[model samples]
Target: MSNGDGSAVRSYHDRTKHSPASVRASRHALDWANQPLAFKIYETLEPIALPRELPPIDVPALEAIARIESSTANECVPDLPTLTQLLYYSAGITRRITHPGGEIYYRAAACTGALYHIDLYLVCGDLPALAAGVYHFGPQDRALRRLRPGDHRRTLIEATGDEAATAAAPVILVCASTYWRNAWKYQARAYRHCFWDAGTLLANLLAVAAARTVPARVVAGFVDRAVERLLDLDPGREAAIALVPLGHTRDRPGPAPDAPPLGLRTVPLSAHEVDYPAICAAHLASSLETPEQVRAWHGQTPRPVAPAPTGPLTPLTPLLGATAPRDAIDRVILRRGSTREFGRVPIGLAAFATTLERATRGVPADFLDPPGASLNDLYLIVNAVDGLRAGAYVFHRERAALELLQEGDFRRDAGYLGLGQDIPADASADVFLLADLAPVLARYGDRGYRAAALEAGIIGGKLYLAAYAHRLGASGLTFFDDDVTSFFSPHAREKSVLFLVALGMSARRAQVVPSA
Candidate 1:
């Protein structure tokens, strides 16, 4: 891959893409004997146990999924219990399936292939029940292991260009990805999955924070090396992807002490690791090097091109209060799972409309200026729905309507675009998020690639919750990137594929969280 240029970014994207010929010609098989460890375990640290007695979030799942920011007016800081809830629901283990070989631990969010590659770390000042420190959240035991023992938020404040949220935040959450853990299955494309999996987890994180009335905002722009250094991460194996500043504070941290290396030890993920140079090169190309560069990188959100309605337009009628489901956020997340096999059943148009409406409302991130602006446009292949025609369509977010792009059944094409996956063909509807990367890369630079994929995953995560609320099923699927754009073109000629999500009825019921 080329170095330090936009073409290098495109090189990684194009090389990792799935196509008909590439899928058939490749001989990449799973190495079951050397599968990576599920958890990133520290061998020499003591675990500070978190509270097992958790509080219930009573906010309705639908209500919280649509909300972008907290409604609280006065300043509030999360206590030990509130902090516990945030970590537990977002990534903590909620259920275990006992197999003959051993057990499979399922987390709060659905990850690609159940690998659980994403990890969360908390950096905060002195709180009511906790001391100032940098800590790693261990889901295996529902406890935190301190990595450094002093206030390090000042370092983060500077890393994020002293952004308003990070400066005022009392607690911040940093999400990072260990390449080998996910790359064991995905190989080079694991770089993309890094943001996709984190986006899904952020969905859970943001929703739980909102239900608890804690102000949480996602910061994607930062001095990458600065954050990696604060978290004591090795750029080779693990690197920071996103940050969430939780709660507001008038108080600010003074200068942080010099971070001498802790040199902590951890269990090995596998006996041998395969190095993918493209992943590192792509990350380096996108990474911001200094505060000055970080400040200049962000600007106005890219406006999408919404052509005039070329066909029939059906305005979305999402269910409102008193008519929508009242299930709490906890219940929805606990029941959520990636649908293994989608049944060819027709769901109500209202249910489909509601999911799209709530999930695309907005993402609370720095890249999306003015709150509700989005980088991607939604194009869909509707196969089964009660009130809507079975055809190709594009969703107009501002107008809240689905404009028919073409009137026909494309079940075969749906499966093809999804890389010959049955889930897309058999599902009620398939949504492909396409982005005009020229503007995204031009505006946000190579890092914009990360932002576009991240935003798609966040919205994709919300779609998961929204679908579950209506008793429907949802799954994130891989695609043949160029093929998708071609299928949705003339209109999408300049656009590129970012993500795909399928929604339908489930073939079998998903496992639920066992009661205590």
Candidate 2:
């Protein structure tokens, strides 16, 4: 497998899959004393404090999540206060938990192992309060530290091949991941976590942008080396994953000034870090090198047309009228947390249907073809839901219905598929996101893996918000990859599992600690 071929990604996927037998055969143990720090710190740079005093948006969570386009005109630009609120609610540290050894700072979105590996950066022209520059977001201090002293939005525009969204945007945010931060726990599979964690953050960002009626779009196609150079990142250690254009403006940026080397100082993540060659190889194989390749990658691919519904289909009954929850976007995010324990309580059918319908409507992304078509299929193991049968079902987004596949109680099977976890067994339903990787890789090359995982994470994030808004609980869980596919065999025999989310009522409420 080489950098130019898609076979590398397929080989990497096959090599990293987890199974019951494989788990016992491998002897990997946690290095507790050598754990890497979760946050990146710039030792020499002075932090320009961001305004902590901010007001919450009044848009309802459901209304915000359901919005695919902004109602306000695209000429509106986001001011400093609005930007502050967006960054705070998207990735800021919202809660802290104390234990005997130390304290843990939980962030706005859920991450695998709570290892906050993803970092956000801002690139913008002169705004109301902020100067024209490139800056890194320091969630640790709730501040922004300037990395470059002038407008660099044109650099991103050129790298993205003058993408429509980038051409007309006033502000753009770059999301990157530090491999060692998450690899310390997840090992080689940390590559997948890069997109998952970033997608969760984007989920929050898109919803908030819509609530404020700001135009935004997620750009996944870009020249990898150009972005790394602009961010001053070591491609091997830290790599850019996605670019998001914030608010739209009619004014286009001029040619960017020369980007020179700035050897800045930063605190190390740990005393020593371990390297995973497989992770690096996979990333390299999927990287796009030229503007032409980026443009070609953006071309739409024909998705397999869905066959007419022949199986028994149950139309979804989403709560749309007066019964929908009116919680604000900020309040929903602050209250969002992974459910540690799910009580065996059946949720209302309308609530369940609404969550599924609203979350899968579509994501404003570059990789998805025809704008609204999804790369992954939704599969469910229904344990409890009012007016729904206890069995397995596959969601047909085109028809907005669930096609019954198997009819029987499989709570124990669900638990086993989720790596022997009790959450899936006790939850009302376990939503499994699976994708047919063959066509995806064939169309977009190895980068499709990132797109598939990211789509899952975004939808999973929306599910978390939906559950919380409706007064339910949801948690993103890991599962045995092959087992998940096998459990939904025949219907999903050729597909691969991308992500899982368990939804139900929480047995105990989580405590929220104020930020320090």
Give the winner by lDDT. 1
TM-score of each: 0.97, 0.96
lDDT of 1: 0.88
Model 1 C-alpha RMSD to native: 3.2
- Candidate 2: deviation at residue 147, Å? 0.6
Per-residue lDDT over 157-239 for candidate 1, one digit per residue giving the tens place of the 0 to 100 score: 99888888889998999999999888888889999999889999999999899888899988999999889988888899988
Model 2 over residues 97-127: C-alpha lDDT tens digits? Answer: 8999889897998889999999999999999
Q: In model 1, where do residues sit more than 4 Å from their true spots?
A: 1-5, 509-516
